[model samples]
Each structure stands twice: as structure tokens, then as C-alpha cells.
Target chain A: MRDRVELLRDMVLVRQFEERCARLYQEAKIRGFVHLYVGEEAVAAAVMGVLQPRDRAVATYRDHGHALLKGVSPEAVMAEMYGRVDGCSGGRGGSMHLFDVAHGLYGGHGIVGGGLPIAVGLALADKLQARDRVTVCFFGEGAVAEGEFHECLNLAALWSLPVVFCCENNLYAMGTALERSEADTDLSVRAATYGLAAWSVDGMDVDAVTHTAQRAVEMARGGAPCFVECRTYRFRAHSMYDPELYRDRAEVERWRERDPIDLHRTRLEASGDLEPGAFDAMRAGVDAAIDRAVAFAESSGLEPLDQLTRHVYAAGPEAGR
Target chain B: MSRVTCRDAMGRAIRRALLEDDRVFLMGEDVGRYGGCFGVSKGLYDEFGPERIRDTPLSESAFVGAGIGAAIAGMRPIVEIMTCNFSLLALDQILNNAATLRHMSGGQIGVPLVIRMTTGGGRQLAAQHSHSLEGWYAHIPGLTVLTPATVEDFAGMLGPALADPDPVLIFEHGGLYNVDAELPDEDPAVDINKAAVRRAGQDISLLTYGGSLPKCMAAADELAASGIEAEVIDLRVLRPLDDEAIVTTVSRTHRAVVVDEGWRSGGIGAEISARIMEQAFWELDAPVARVATAEVPLPYPKHLEDAALPSVPAIVGAAKELLGRG
Candidate 1:
């Protein structure tokens, strides 16, 4: 197990990194649908912490945190959001569609439940090829309503595919709350009916998520799927365009009380897992890294207009055109 | 040396693909013990067993997306959707993930996946299983759509499709599955890029593919008896269509007719007719004639089904009209 201090750093980096992204969006540096991962850092951080470099990770649109945790250079991710040629996706996938195959991060799938089947496939390939890598797919509670969620769960279990479905039940699918969307609000319980190891954990606690994810990853590596419901919250509105009309201010304030980064910091500081002055030094390091990322994004060039048709097919002059 | 059904040729192609590459697998609903819905994969399950030849649940979105994923993760997967009609259930995955993954990922990924589905109408399977929709797939930039019309194309296209890194869709007309042809002494040379001149003449050029191929051939035979040599061009590849073959044949014959089993409005026939207008307009002695399926959903009755589809009479009528002999 990684020490609480490192987990603490991962969560802090996500919190501050996305805070910068929000400011960038406001300043018009980043355009398109920007979904901030304000309160859901622990889910991505801890899950990514448990995954080996060989294991794959697939995430949804609010995916900056996952990209960061999966080892995509903060520079490349920020550049991608900036829609520059230097972006990880060569500026083809804006904020909603980041991809870094080398780090085992499949993509930032824009569709609600699109990544689930792809995750099943990645695990299917691994299982067939006799590799023990586990594929961890992250989606929101909104996706539970999609038929793909049910189909993928059944297929993965039926095939004993090595995949871990981590549902970040942030209680909303865009603006629809979990209760409004799901017939039964307990997402993991519905998942368990598919005959896999299913459970929900406090997504607000970094240590708890880390512990749960460790077991889930191992369970998947043993040659069947596992399901984890990280009951977290997105402190911000769904997107930059959202007006914040659906949820109560009081409810948002209440979930803010259990902020994942702050809660983890307090626990580590009291447990002496974090040394004196370590908190300040860690935040400083995160700021410097993010500063470099921002600088790279600002300095990067946009892809040329003529190159637009490139990569549509794998090559051959007749393909993409 | 012998004659073989197009379906058997297709099965042999898939079986050979599985044997040549360890990374190849055939997956779809009823593809294993059920022996494939169309019987194209009849003996493959017995030969390759359950590991390489796997049966999937009836969820098209999941299994198709799984095939796309497996392709991206470095495997050549041959996914068989029962028919083009059911392919609609998996269209989101096909268009979104399989087709879009390559360009959207900015050259970081390529889906070396081949999806095969039976298409066209002659059987009374009615509305659900009879419509031809490969035209819709050909409209996408990231996909390669091939409508194989001959036993050679059926036996030949899969190998190259699996070897290519892009997503390719092979639409085998359901009506032509049982059509028989002499097995070539050696495997007839074929590719996924060009059209073939099935029969040559000078009076008019007959453009067609898939189930429409035989109808056009019969139309040519009928025209030949009347002393009109009608050129027959098999438009095997639909996506990046062989425009040169179309222009060359039309440029020579000075009259053209497009035959398609898909619907008339916005169908591939329309696209081909438009291409003729664009590239070989001055060469045309008259407006290009189009022979496409009627716009109505196909009915279950055999007579109505045949009536709704392009037939030899329709092709012959269109060809004669193009030559001012209507």
C-alpha cells in the first residue's frame, strides 16, 4: 500500500489542477464542455493508485482527474484542453475526449455509457491473451439508466472478463439527481445482481477508496469482473454552461463538509503520517507542476487547418479523405 | 475445380483468418454452438472451439463495442452481426467508437475490426432483416464499406480487411448467400478498393453490386440477345468507391444505369448517379438511370419482396431507357 502522504498528494494535485482549469475556462483559455472534478478527486486518485502501469483505465467526460492519476503528463492534458497540436490527442479531442494509450488510459469517452463496453473489450483481450491486467472503467450514476450498463455488466460477468466497473455515483447525471434517474438509488446493489463482487464505499474518504479499490483490482485480476460504487459528489455544477438550478445550495454545502482532500489531509496530519510542514511543501509542488502545465498550454501551437482529415483512418492517402 | 455457395466461401474466409493469426477471433450472437444465424460460421465453432469462436449475448451494443475495444487493444476481431437490420442496435458503437476512435484519438488508435452482416432482400424476412444500409456506413469517413458480390470477393475480402488497421464493414447480401459459382482453380485475385468489370460491351454501362449484380448480369444477357452489348461493372467496394472505374466505363459506353438494393432516396445509387454527373456528364448521351428498391418497407410475401427489390426486368428497362430504347 502507498503511504497516506502520496495519496494525499494525488488528491491535492487533482483539486488544485482542476481549480486552475475552472479559472482557465472563465478566462477563455479552455473552451467546450468543462466538467470539474471538484469533490470527486479521491475516487480517481485511489483507484488509479491501485492500478498497475500495465492495467487499463477508461473514464467519462469529467475525466481530467483520471488522466492526471493515470500518469498523462499534466502538460499534455492541459495542452489537450487548450486544443493545441501538442495536446495528447493532437487537439482532436478537446476537454471531453482526451486519450493516452501509452499510460494505459484508453480515453475520455464523451458518451454516457460508451466506455463500459470498451472496458469490457480491453479486459476481454487481456483475458484471451492470458495477461492478468485489469481494466477499471469509471462512469457516473447517470449511466446506470443506460441499457449499456446492464448489458456490459452481464457480458463481463458471463465471460469472466478482467474488468472493474467503478461507478462514481456523484448523485447526478448532468442535472438529473440519482433518485430522479434510477428506480433504485442504490447502484451497487443492482450491480451485485449480475453476480460479481459489488459494493459501495465512501468516495469522500481517500484511504477508504484506496482500500476498497485494492481488493476490487485483485478480484478482477483473478479473472472475473468486480463493481465498486464510489459514492462521491461533484461540488461544482455539471458543466460550465449549467446554471446550478437543480440542487439546493444547502445540499452542496453539506457535501462540501466531507471534501476528500481536506478530510484526508486532516487524518494524515493527526496520525502523524504527514510530517510537520509537509502539507505546505506538497501544495507548493502541486502548484509548480500545474504552473508548468499552464505555461506549456499557453505556449503550444494549434494544429494546422490542412491536417484536419488526418488520422481518420490508419493511413493510405485514400482512407481519411 | 468445383462449385461453392457464396456462404461457404465466406465461411472458409473466416476460418482461414482464424487459422492464420493467433490474434484473430470470431464473435457474435449464435456464432458458436448455434452455428451462426445465417450458417456462414457453421463449422467454425467445431474447428476452433469456444475460445477463438465465441457466442455473445444478444446485446449488439456491448459485443460490437467489445469488438471495437479488442481491435484497439491489438487484436483482429471478425464480428458478425446477424443482418444489417440488427446492426442498427449497434450503430452507436459502430459509428461512435469503432469509426470515431481513430481520428478522435489523433492517430493514437486504430480499430482493425471487420464487421460482417447479411444484407439486401429476396427472402421474406420482412422489414427487420431485409433492408440494405451499408450506404449509411459508407458515408462515414473513418470506415471502409465493401459489398462483396462474387464467391471470389466473399472468399477474398476478409483477409485484407483483417490486415488493414481501419474499421471495415462487409455486407454480404442475404439473397445471394446460396448463389453458386465455379470454385476458381486458384483463389481469384481481389481487393477491398476497386470495382471489377464483370462483362464488357459498348452500348451502355451497368453499375451494380451485391444482390443487384446478378440482376444486372441477367439484364446484360437479355440486352446481348437484342444486339446491345451492355457493359457490367461490379461495384465491390462501396466506401471510397472506385470512381475511376465508373468514369472510365461511363466515358466509354456514353450511357449508364445504377442498380442498388438500398432505397432510392439518398441511396448509394443516387451517390453513384451524382458521381457520373460530376465526372462523366458530357460523356452521357442521356441522364443516368437508377434502379433501386422501392421506398416502402419490404413486405413478407415473396412476390411483394421481389417486386420491391431491383430485378432483371427493372435493370433491363433502365439500361434500354439509357440507350433511348425504352
Candidate 2:
């Protein structure tokens, strides 16, 4: 059995880190579309728990939680939010484009549905090179409407590529609800139409997400692409700029009642997985980590303007000549 | 040396690349079983098998983006779009991902992908299938745009483009696919960076590329008959244009006429004209002139299509006008 306490700890860490980010945004410390994963922590924590170090991942813009869970340092992620040189993307890509190639996190793609084809190609490379690795591409419900979604799914299934398409259906694609965008609201069914094994899981429950993702990862490792729709909800507005005009206050309140962290903590406590003061100690540790991240972000230096165009092309024999 | 068509030369290039590198593969619509829409990959499928000579569905965005992904993941994938007209479907992947990935990822990844597409118009394919759009791709900063106008270039450009660290787009003129040219036994190593001086003259410079090169060469012969020596420069590389070559030729001749198959306004000819004005203003004996396609959708009729495209007469007229000898 997997450690329920560790899962709970990760979710709590994400929650605390995002809450701190919200306060920082309010103070004008972090700029440019800061998308918080306040309530969608369980999906990232659980899904990432099943991925090995060798496996690759491609995440969307609201990727702080995914990056952190995938082994990108909290300090680097926050520094990226601060647009500091020490950030994972060296301050070139801000919050919406966190990238850590060393950790196998491909990128935080800004465009919707942009990562799907890249994921397929990555899987194709592994299959061609005879490497036993899986590439997990995480996109939102909004990405399903893109032509690339259908095209990539067909290609992946046709090639039997080692790819696990993780759709974190947090209901909103920017302010538009999934039901409003998609005529057929069932995402897993749409993925199944591509002829790959597809299913959905309870995104709020860590155990459910982990169990479902583990099976999908196994299927991908066996050279069959699989799709999983994580039915989750984002508690906060889509971004710092969103006034949330599309969502109702009552709906947000109702979804908050199923807050992933609270449910996981309650489950752990009921199963005797937590000691009397364990939750408090874990919270304290998470708070300290967030504080350290904030300090690192604040103290980090900005990138020099002269080096602005350094990475436009890789350093090569004829590059920049 | 042996004579070969541009089609056979390109097929030879793909075969050579596949044989030389275990990581290289070809993927595109109708590239495998159907032998490519233009028959550029006629026997590659049978030779390399389905895994390497992959025939993809008509999903340009996915396959092109997949090529970029495979390139980043340590595989050299040469993706072909049937024609430049259909390449608009995958422009998002080419512009947003392949061109931006290395810089956006803080240089952690490089897309060593090569995309080849048939461009220009000569067949009665009409508007949708006929139009030169290489100038559009040339506008993007991170992309390397190449227009191979010779048989050696058509056969040799692919190797260096695949070896490059960034994305390279090769635009093969549709009309030149069947043109015959002699290839040396040991094909001279072609550089995608330099513009080739196809013919040398001293009276005026005729600058052109791709489908316009032959017309410009013919115009030079006609000009020579009129005692006007026209220097012919084939602009093999479009992006990071050989500005030095352009300026040097114009400096010697002191006059220039740019010929392009694309529309005059905002076309590559316009860019070359502006570069001449910027860098060779003092060297020019007369104003730089341009011969380009008439700004209309290419027609289906042969006579009207020929009239609309940049012709030898148009290049000769433009050169005479630039030299004030009309």
C-alpha cells in the first residue's frame, strides 16, 4: 500500500504554496497571469506519484503544482514566478512557461492543446530508440476542443505510442465551463473514440487518482497509449486577472466543500494514518518551505538585458554567425 | 556526372540520410504507400519500411508538432507537408512550438527538425494549390528558410538542415521537380548560407530565387543579346539572407532587378529591395527594380497563369528599366 500520509503531505504543501502565491500576487510581487492550483492539488500529487524519474511530463499553464510534484524545486518555481534569473527557465519563461528538462518536465506550455503533439513525438522517439519510457501530457478540459486533440489522439493510437494523456478536467477553460464548450461533456468517451483505453477517476480523492493513473502508466509502458480524465475542480479564479464572472458563488462554495486536502486529511485521520500532532507538524513544515521559497524569489537577481537573446538558438558551430 | 531530375535528387537525398543515420526518418501524408503526392519519395517506403518512411494521415499540426518533439527527444525527423498551401494548417506548431521551444525552455531543448514542403505554382492547380509562401516563413526569426533552386542544392540541403541545431524549412519549388540537371559524381558540398552566382556579368545584377532563377537566367541571355551584361545571383537561402552577396553584386554592377514568384507587396522581393536600398544605396547607378507575380490568386489557364507569374520578359524589362536602356 502507498503511504497515505505522504500523499496528504504533498497536497497540503501545494495548497500552502499556492495560498502564499495568492498573497504575493496581491502585493504585486508576482506578475503576469498567476494561475493557482488551489483545489486541484490532489490530481497532480496523485498522478505524479506514479511517474518514474525516467518518464517525461508536459503540463499546462497552471503548472506550479505539477512542476513541484515532478521534482522541480519550490524555490526555482517561485523564482520563475518572480521572473528571476535563477528560475527554472532562467527568467525567460515566467509563470506560464516553467520548464525543467533535468527533471524530465518538458515545459509549461502556454497555448491550449499545444503539448499533445509534442507528447506524441516524445513517445515516438522513445519507441523508435527502443527506450522503455512513458510521456504523460497533462492538459485541461478546454484543450479537448482543439483539432490537435483529435489529431494527436489518432496518431498516438495509430502508432501505439507510449503516452498517457492525463486530462485534468477542472471544468473551466479560462472562464468558459466544459459543458458550454463541449457538446459531449464526457471527455473519456471522446478519447475512447480514438480507440485507446480511456477512463475517468475521482480527482479529489488521492487514492482514486493514484490507482487510476498507475494502471494507465502500466498500459503506456506496455506500448499502448491510454487516456484518463481526472474529474477535478479549481477553487480559485482561472488566473489573477479573472473576475470569475462566469462561475456562480454557490457553485464555488459547493466545490469547496469537497476540497481535496480536507477530504484526504479527514480520510487519513479516520484510518489512524495520522498521529495527534502530526497534521500540525506537517503544516508547520509546509509553511516554512513556502517562506523559504518566497525569500529565495525575493532575493534572486534579474537577468541581464544583454543576454536577452542568448537561447534563441542553441550554441553551435554556425549558430549566431 | 550524370543528369538527374530534382525529384530523383530529393529522393536520393532522403535515401542517403536514412542510410547514413539510424535516427533519421521520413513522415508525411502519402509519403509511404502512395509514394508522396509529388512522387518525391517514390521507393523510400519499401526500402526503409513503414517505421522509417511513415505515411501519416492528413493531420498536419500533429505530425509537424510530433516531428519537433521527436527532434527534441534525440531523433532526426524530416517531415514533409504535401504543399505550402496545406502547411497553413500546421503553422501553429511550426511558429509557436518548434520555433519557440529552445528559447522558451531556457535552451534546455533544441528542435533539430527539418520540414520540407513543395512551393510555387505552375500546374493548373489554381489558387488554393498555387502561391509562393516561403516569404511568410522567412519572416519568423528562429526559422531557417531555404529555397533550393538547383539539383545539387535540392539533394544536398537536407543533410545540413538535419544536422543544424534549430528548425529548418526547405521550400521546394513545385515546377522544378521534373527539371533535369547534371549532378557531379562527387556532389559538391552545398552550403545553405551562401547565395550562388549562377552567371557573371558587369552591366547589371539579376537577383532571384527558387522558381524565378531560370527566368532570371533566361533574361540574362536575352540581356546579353542586347549587349547588357546581367549578373545572375540565385538566392538559395531566404532567411538570414546572403546580404553580403547581394550588396557585393550590386556594388559591382551598380544596378539590380529583383525577380520573385510571390506577390510584389510584402514579398521577399520587397525585403531584398529594402535591403539593397539600406546597404547599397551609394553603389546603385539607378533605382532597384522588382519583377513579381501580379497580386491576384493564380489562375488555372496556362496563358493567364504565365502572364501573372514573373516571366523572362518581365525580368528583362525590369533590368532594362533599371539600367535606363528600355
Candidate 3:
């Protein structure tokens, strides 16, 4: 068992990274659509704890937390968000399309529900190759309605693929609430309909998300893919540009009171696993990391127009062959 | 020596592919115990078992994406859609994901997946089931399209397709499932990226593939009787189209006729004709002619269905027009 100090540090790091991204978005340093993974740090930090290095993960637009926790360099991810050649996707994909193949991070897909099948495919590959790797796919409540989601679940259940479908029920698919969108609000029950085991975990509690995801990931690696619905809420607006007119401010404030980062801090203090001085030190370290990532992104160069069509076709001098 | 149909040749090719690589597997509706909708995958389930000859739910997009994923993971996956028409439902996975993954990943990943599907109309399967969209797919850069018209093409293309580094889409004509011919025991291995001259001649070049190849061959025979001596070229590979072969043949013949069962406008025939005009314009003695299916949803009536698609008479008529014999 990891000391509460390390778990608290992980949560703090993810929270700081997301807070920095929100600042960058406001400052206009990172262009294109930016969806910050704030208020949902527990989902990534906790789930990533038990993910083996060989395992793969796919996330949606709200994916910075997932990427950072997956061990992709903060500098590389921020550089990608800034559209620099040194970025993971080489600036081809902006904030919403960050890809780090080296870390087995498939991407931060822009399209809702599009990444579900892709995650299943990755898991299917692991099963076919007889590899002991499991793939964890993360999506939002908004994705439950898409045909791609249901279709992939059917195949995954039918073949018993090694995948853990983690639905971060942030309660909104853009501006629409889960109740307004899905006929069945309980997303876990839908997975059960497909013949796979399903469960719901408190997304705001890091330990809860971690423990539940560990069991699901184990089942997936053991030969049957599993589905986990993390009943969480996003305190921030859907995107940097969203006016957030769909939901009430009181609701956001209520969820914010149960913020996962603050909850972890309190738990650490109560358990005598962390002193106030140590917590302050961890925040300072996180702040320094964020500063360095911002500097790296600022110094990184932009791709030239001559290479606009470079990766569009898989052949020639520009194909990065 | 053994006699086999195009469908039988495809089955043998699949069996050989399965034997050659344990990674090679078939997955689709009725491809296993049902022996495929057209029986093209007949007897595969019994030999390879359900593991290799797996049957999938009616989720074209998901399964096709899975095939792409499997291909990238170092396995050879052959996904079959019931027909070319239904592939539209899987277009997101096929075009956006499978076709673009190689380029989008900047060549870090290449999908060696093969998607086989039925195409063309003659069975009166109605509007929804019968149509050819190979021409639209040929326009894409990353994918290679093939239409195996001859039994040799059916048998020869699979091995090479399985070896190619990129994705390959093979359109097996539903109308030609029962086509039978004497296939030589000695395998005449061929490339999947080149066109083949089915018959050699000098007066005119008749270009076609899939269901229209036999019609072009019949037209060639009739034109030969009339002393036109038409050369027929079967385009086994659709995309990265064998421009050299078509240009060289048209340059020799100096006149050309294209036969396609797709619609006339913006069809594969239209693209072929445009290419001939651009590359071999000076070699041509007259304007190129074409025989394409009529522009309409294929109706259920026998005569309406027959009238909606290209036939032997249509190809013969187009050839005569190009020869100024009409």
C-alpha cells in the first residue's frame, strides 16, 4: 500500500496541471478548443496508479489529467496544446487531439464516443496477441447516446475483450445533462445489458475510483472486459469558451465543495500521513513543473507550411519515414 | 488441372491465407458456420474453427475498427461486409479510422487489414443491397482497391494483399459468385497494384473490371468477328490505378471504350476516361466511349434490374460506337 503522502502528491500534481491549463487557455497561449480535466483529477490519478506500463488508455477532449497521469511528459503535452513541432503529435493535432504513441496514449479525441471502439480495438489486439496488457477507455456521460459506443460494447462483450470502459459521468455531454440525454440515466445498467459486469464509483473520491478501477482492470486483463461508471461532476464549464448557461451556478458550487483534491488533502491530514509543511512543498514542486512546461511550450517552434501535406499521405520524403 | 469458379477461388485463397499465417482470420455475419452469405467462405469454419473463422454482430463500424486495431497489433484481419452498399454504415471506421490511421499517425502505424465485400447489381436484391462504391473509395490516398474479375485474379491477389504493408479493399462481385472456369494448378502469382491485359489486340482498348469484365470479353469477341480487334484490360487494382498499362494499351490501340456497372456520372469509367484523355490524348484517334449502369435506384422487376446495369449488349454497343461501326 502506498503511503497517503504519495497519493496526496499525485492528486495535487494533477490538480495543479489542470489549473495551469485553465490559465493558459484564458491567456490565449493554447489555441483551438480546450477542455480542462479540472474537478475530475481523481478519475485519472487513481486509475493510473494501477495501470501497468504496457497497458494502453484512450480519453476524450477533457483528457489532460489522463495524459499527465499516464506518464507523458508535462512539457510534451503542453507543447502539443500550444501547437509546436516538438509536441507529441508534431503539432498536427492541437489540444483536443494530443497523441503520444510512445506512452500508449491513443489520443485526446475531439469527437464524442469515437474513442470507445478504438479502445476496444487496442484491447482486442492485446487479447489476440496473447499479451497480458489491458486497455482502459475513458469517456463522458455524453457518449452514452452515440451508436459507436453501443456497437463497441456489444463486440467487446461478445468477444470478452480485455478492456475497462471507464465512463466519467460528468453529468453533461457539452450542454446537455445525462437525464436530458439518455433514456436510462444509469450508464452501468446499459453495459449489463451487453452482458458485461458493470459498477458505479464516487468520482470525487480518489480511493474509491482507484479501488473500483483496480478490480475492473483486473477482470479485463483476466479475459473479460468490464465497464465502470464514475459518477462525477465537472465544476468548470464544458470548455474554455462555454458560457455554461445550461446548468445553475449553485449546482457547480455544491460539487465544488466536494472537490476531489480538497477531499484528498483532508483525508491525508486526518490519517497523519501528511503535515502542512509537506503539502506546501508538494504544491511548490508542482508549480515549478508547470512553469517549466509552459516555458518549453513557449520556446518550441511551429511547423512550416511547406510540410502542410506531409503526414496527409503515408509516402514520400515528408512522411516522417 | 482443376475447374473452379471465382467464388471457389476466393475460398481457396482465404484457406491458403489462413494456413500461411495463424494471424489471418475471417470475421463477419454468417462467414463461419453459415459459410458466408454467398458461400465464398464455405468450409472455412469446419477447418479453422470459430476462433479463426469468427462471426461478429451486425456492427460494421465497430468490427471494422477492431480489424484495423488487430492489424496494427501485428495480426492479419480479413473483415467482410455483406455488400459494398452496407459499407457506408462502417464508413467512419473504414475511411476516417482505418484509411487515415497510417497517415494520421505519420506512418508510425500501418493497417494491413483486408475488407472484402460484394458489389454490383443483377440479383434483384433491390435498391438498398446492390450498388458499387469502389470508385469513390479509389479516390482516397492511403487505401488500395482491387476488383478481381478472373479466377486467377481471385486466387492470385489474396496472398499479395496479405503481404502488402497497407490496407486493401477487395470487391467480389455478387453477380459473379457462380462463375466457373478451369484454373491451372500452377499458381500464376500476380501483383495487386497492376492491371492485366485479358486479351491482346490492336484496334481498340476495352477497359473494365468486376461484373463488367465478362461483358467486355463478350464485346471483344463480337468486335473481333467484325475485324475491330479490341484489346481488353481488366483493372484488378483500382486505386494507384495502373495508369501505365492503360496509357500504353490505349496508345497502341489509338481508341478506347470503358465498361463499368456503376453510375455514368463521376463513375470509375468517368475517371478512367478522364485519365486516358489527360495522359494518352495524342495517341487516341477518336473520343473514348463508356458502358455504365443507368442512373437510378435498382428496381425489383427483372427487366428493370437488367436495364439498370451494364450488360454484354451495352458493352458491345459502346465498343461499336468507339469503332464508328454503330
Native interface contacts kept by each candidate, as a fraction: 0.73, 0.72, 0.33
Error of 3 at B277 (Å): 3.7
- What shift in Å separates residue A208 of candidate 2 from its native position after superposition? 0.5
Task: Write model 2 residue lDDT over A228-288, tens digit each, in one string.
Answer: 9999999998998899999899999999999998898888888888987889999999999
| Native contact share for candidate 2 | 0.72
Q: After superposition, how far is residue B316 of candidate 2 from its true place, in Å?
A: 0.9
Lowest lDDT sum, 10 consecutive residues, model 1 chain B, at B183-192
lDDT of 1: 0.91
What are the candidates' individual DockQ scores?
A: 0.79, 0.73, 0.41
Which residue runs of candidate 1 sit more than 4 Å off their true CA positions?
none
> Best by lDDT, which number?
2
Quality of model 2 by C-alpha lDDT: 0.91
Q: Which residue pairs in candidate 2 collide? A: none
Q: What would the per-residue lDDT of candidate 3 be over residues A1-321, giving only the tens digit for each residue?
A: 334566677778778887888888778888788887778888888888888888888888787888887888889888888888887777677777667777878777766777787787787778877999888999998888888889988889989899999999999888998889878797888888999999999999989988998899889989888899998888777888899999999999999999998998888788877776778889999899989999999999988877766654445432211
Provide the lowest-lDDT 10-residue window in model 2 chain A.
Answer: A312-321
lDDT values of the candidates?
0.91, 0.91, 0.84
Residue pairs clashing in model 1 are none
Q: What is the TM-score of each candidate against the true structure?
A: 0.98, 0.98, 0.94
